[model samples]
Target: MDDLTCDVAIIGAGTAGLAAERSARSNGATTLLIDETFGGTTCASVGCMPSKLLIAAADAAYGVRHAAVFGIGATATIDGAAVMRRVRNERDKFVAGVEDSIAKIPDAVKICARAKFTGATTLELSDGRTVHAKAVVIATGSAPMIPETFDAVKDRVLTNETIFDLATLPGSVGVIGAGPLGLELAQALVRLGVETMVFDKGNAVAALKDSHVADALHAILEKELPVVLGVETQVVPDGDGVRLSWSGESSGERHFEYLLVATGRPPRLEGLGLETTGLALDDHGTPTYTRETMQCGDAPVFLAGDADHDRPVLHEASSEGTIAGRNAASFPDVTAAERMVPFSIMFTEPNVAVIGVVPEDGAADVVVGTASYTDQGRAKVMACNAGLVRFYADAADGCLTGATMAGPGVEHSAHLIAWAIQSGWTATETLALPFYHPTFEEGLKPALLAICHAVHAKPPPFRDDGFLPGT
Candidate 1:
């Protein structure tokens, strides 16, 4: 067997792996990045980038069809084959870019073969190669979950992994699971003129913790497409497509030309041979790793990205990768710091987003500030007023804790809140920042004002003039 050595060995060359590799190398570690395939990931290949492309096309179609509200009547026709072609063409460019970046990394430090652990610090490749490293970082990503019950009808099931490869859109689709992936593609497909029905075992879509925000998003999505929530779905083969039967919130039977499964993604650990490391496995068959340092026990092994199942968003993956890489390079002396304020966004219509710490139920120290886009100036002008924004703050000090919004331009608002929370700014500090009028941001003013009022319930400190500077 061929032998190789490195200061840090990173498995998987996706976003998280790349970040870890780069960070390790920058820290003066001799890094070896390994992956069976290095072309793209769920993000570049099918998850975020390609999915957004499809969404953009669908949005255009939706905009044109809604132009009648602006007194401009026009017919918009969408060709399924053409839309898929455009999506593939654009998606290929992104994949090509990732491939090109991988190519730039010298082959001497990159291995293009499947690998598993032969020992705690040794790895065996599918080819007759072995790598010995001081530390290892498992950045292996995740795959879409396909239930075994759908095995007979697997040919008709479309996942994020295979949805972008479709030559043409199906006549109708039934989406299982109302998470980000399901709601996003379902809405896009519906807007593109495909009959779509979404089913979820839970009452919430997009995993919104705030009940009001969840209700608002559900209502908005229902106006565009049919959504069945709090239902368990059973699928079976029916001719060319599949038949679905679900019950809980409602009982229903439906047949679709295609079925898309968007259930949870478990950590991918099939062939990695984690037993070799002697690290304890979690109940989910994933390695026990700390989110703070991404370390897997005391074995000098780190896990990042979807493999860790901590925070699977693109930015969070990058951040975790950086920490894992740096810590892996440092080995037994690795150090980790507090994570940044958590942030996430789902790019649906009237985008859903959250930032900072979300308060739990019956939290007496929490105060909620609210606004509705239904009468917001910019939203009314854009004719897309169909959601709400809510901010949560510590009532004791007006410190912004978290926020969840289901309204137009929430993506931008989420960024603003993230920065404020990350910087430890309170509600009053954020509100002091200038907000332009007739803009979507101005809609946030009411919420901020409400928070300021709630936190300042007692007499104003300035009112005690005896101790004031002027007095």
Candidate 2:
């Protein structure tokens, strides 16, 4: 009800907003953090943690059912209700942690209400309170994208926002969009004994850029559940379920009790009243912002997290929030340069990972180094040898630039590759690092060696000799 003034005003109390708030405060700015709801975004509530819990449960069920590979005869049964209950229970703990963090922030500085921009440096709270600030950060985050075509079956359609809330698993599920979320959830659903299928307009699965890696993932996921790609899908109500028809001709239509639209997430920029800021909006309606500084424009306004739609992962969001917050607090005085290399991981069976600069297949400046689980001793022994890892390096300098892989332990490999790339490690130098025998990391050696060869880096005599047992 009163007019308040602060050095910085941070809209949205999600992960990015929280980070920005702390960073701005740490930088000696009187910061006010506002949000209609507390806790973080998709990661805590329904996105990352809950989905991973479901995936883990599904993986355990799959492993037990297929235990005959090691000559163990055991019948595994899954309780759909129990599995979902456990997922939600664990998911709540994470959500509680986020709330606890928000609780620790002084109440005097945090406002639980929708904030609308009244001016470039002013926010009007829904409760009639006005905030006149020197700088502002926008971190409103994003929401699931539901296509207009699915309006016929809107009641049956679910997104990550609602899927985890299911009290019981659907008898059948049709996941529309074979991106990371769709593919991972489809495989988990299949393992949980719920008949599942995935459809995506894009030819690629799990957002993989590398054709070879994408092909491998498509094949592997197809083995678990039907993956329909490169076709438009239509959903119509059929009794209590929904019947799906695609662009291509088919004799029959498939029906599912539930439909998951995991196509993508669009920024939540509807009600914030952006017209007051005079900041340019991108083609996607996202505020035009710089990657290096996170500044919306020449003004002391910033955008971070899913709001920016750049590298929407949690860690990247945090980094961007810190940058935005620090810069907002010190506008026109300091702007930090972006130095972190890009990194992303999809936690599916034999996780999918992309790190650094993904080069084109036949790029003249980059060389491709590839290795398959079929040749890796550890993967073969584990009976999970079904994927590939490919690394891209600067051909002229042999510096490791990027890596894309769909294989066991790829999450760890992705981290290592991202670190090496960020640290400017050459392929030869990475190959020289110790790789123990009969380990998944040993698989990386071959790829790095291939890159060294492509770059014409002469290796030491021991590596050249047939002395290596695995080689």
Candidate 3:
């Protein structure tokens, strides 16, 4: 094939790469989208969609099992095969949607082959074609990190990349890592009647930085499955299964049909011949880039999405891609873009979400407001009354800074808090907004009110209709 050239060349066809391609094209730049395979996004293929499908099934089973609390007699026999079949089937639909989007891009703009950097503005294709571009964007998505300790049980190990492909749910699973992925999957599996246990060397759960929220999550998850934290765990292949032995919080050995490793995902940057680009690399081999501009040093080459190792969630990836693409198209005249407030959610029952700034322990400049579902009216009505919600505000100004929460309807409440923080709303301002009565969202009011009082910014007195005056 003849040498290919474009004004902008984007590596990887995942969420970030696709967004970069669109942004570049819309910016009046001719672009080449290169990847080993097209139309396969991590979110659609294995990461978000598939996992959610499995979680949905698990939630159904849990609802059925706990129906008695609602004064309804119900029982469920989970068909593992059927459950997985639906997961795969629905997951394929999501993948197809991504493929359909890729199909809409002009053929001349898409390169169905792997690419490696030959120079700052040049790439060599695996198929023997060379491309020289004015600017480049690296969006190669990440892969699950498998620790070297699990090498002995490699055959029995399953990461997010391979776990969804199981033909049937395993009889038992030992999850290594207490992060969101591990805990979410472990809980789902246990709810589906599989014996599951989670182990982690750290003393936290999910991505929560607040000790209170982390402890609440750990406690809630433990009621469903054994979550052993702060432990030194050893794994080894034992016949057809894997044996996990831990000594720290407790000492015991257990065997499971499979070990799910959800430790973390590092950017997939290996073998990309980055040294030829002459860009400075960090200790972890990632190119040094400014988050605001996504430019590597002063070079035309840019990094986005998981490849940059900054906020690997889908939305952040897309946002980074847009910024990187536009900046790459603009080249040396690149402009920096403002970033959105950080927001993330784990789809556990009574979701876990962390938004914006998380104050350190005993931070004098931060005031915290808290609420517990243990006595929340709506939560008690739904029989899901357990978890904690906390809002952190600037002690000096009472402006909402961030929040870490693990509670019923937190996924929605977190968004509100994140928006309030982004809009520079203070506790008084946020409390002025209406909160419906007897709803899970109303639980957020107590926390906001606490912030108002803590920061010495009391809300206005309620009017005759029992509503605080609008700010």
Candidate 4:
């Protein structure tokens, strides 16, 4: 209705915010998109994409060391600066390329300056501008949760955010927390001749997908890096090298030249003037939203990303952002929901990729099939490789429910598994599908053969094409 008015105002121009903008606009509403910055932590800077490029360099470095294993007799020196250069070059190319995430939407999505709530329906901008929308969405995402004890050690300590900014890699580093980020960075360092130590407070590699997959991943990591598990570290300063004073069954303190904190994450809603809005944040300042609407109890407001806490992930944030934006435009009734396949990856020594109905929170009765790289034809040809592929299915129907792999090119396979699970495809249906031979895709076939075993317990009758039975 006015220059400063719109049908929807979406905050945080990251994945979620951008997705929301597109969704709202497509539904025939003018939208204004605002963010303190674009792409937040995950996409633009230290998030998955750039980190992946770094991982690729780390892999190449590994190849240089193992060239003889590949039948090439040459020694190569790892150049850390060169690797960073490759990262910058790739990052530049990505930015120069068309960004589909922020490009081409139905309605006018204006980028506003640093925005904060001035009223229930109003936002104040950094440049003394004010905008009003029928509904507001906050998708501001998460930041690295630095532990209190580790504050003084930041000179020698770094978050995952700053680890990539190193011109020269550390000779030895202690990475706390064996989550995806920790493992990923550990592999990067270890591959580059850094004597890296990874510390997971738990069993060091309790994979979110399934324990079987975690075991395979553990085998892979054991060969590549030194790991300390089930020990809590009280991180403090100790000379040039920082000391991690830890005690458990084994009570002792260990020291490292550099310490990386990968404990967990807190919601990133600070400095946006939340105090002015009077919205509720948990003790950690994260917004509370129901799993259903993902809306705060406050009127005309929606939340997404790490802030929302349904699932703190890039894809999850993108999906939630879109839904929030669309609902903001619709206002009274929103049809969107948060159903996630949540394909996750850990770029460790033996990289892991997973998608499925995970084995947490009493999700029982899974029909699973396991295939390893050593057993698969493609893996033998790959020259130097190790890992496994496992698919989980509903035992009753043999419908493939989930899949996890810690093998080469598992990211691509995760997509396929996610599709199969979401489509409710039975294992037999997967078997009927022609998979190319001498490729990782064929590994799915053996998985189907195993699925036949599960079906035979009370086997389904064979079809005309000899499908569905255990024959």
Please provide the root mean square deviation of candidate 3 (C-alpha atoms, Å).
Answer: 2.6
Q: Taking the tens digit of each residue's C-alpha lDDT, what string does model 4 give over 207-299?
A: 454777777778778788866677777777788888877667556667788987787766677776766666677776666665556676646
The candidate maximizing lDDT is: 3
- lDDT tens digits, residue span 1-471, model 2: 679899999998888999999999999999999998786666899788999999999999999998999999988788999999999999999999998999889999999889999888999998999999999999999999998999999999999999999998889999999888888898899999999988877888987889999998888878888898888887789999999987753324688999999999888889898988898988887788788999887888999998888788999889888999999999877576755899889988889999888887788989999988865778878888888899998889899989998898888877888889999999877766667777788878778888888888965445641325433
The residue pairs in collision within model 2 are none
CA shift of 3, model 4, Å? 10
State the number of backbone clashes in model 1: 0
Q: What TM-score would candidate 4 get against the native?
A: 0.85
Compared to the true structure, candidate 3 yields what TM-score?
Answer: 0.97
TM-score of each predicted structure versus truth: 0.95, 0.97, 0.97, 0.85
Two-way TM-score contest, 1 vs 4, winner: 1
Pairwise TM-score winner, candidates 1 and 2: 2
**Candidate 2: worst-modelled 10 consecutive residues by lDDT:** 462-471
Per-residue alpha-carbon lDDT of candidate 3 for residues 1-471, written as tens digits (9 for 90 to 100): 899989999999999999999999999999999999885899999899999999999999999999999999999999999999999999999999999999999999999898999899999999999999999999998989998999999999999989889999999999999998898898899999999999988888885789999998889888999999889989888999998899997889999999999999989999999999999999989999999999999999999999988798999999999999999999989999989998889989879999989999889999999988888788888899898999999999899989998999887888888899999999888878887777888778778888887878768577122323210
What TM-score does candidate 1 reach?
A: 0.95
Clash totals in order: 0, 0, 0, 0
Clashing pairs in 1: none
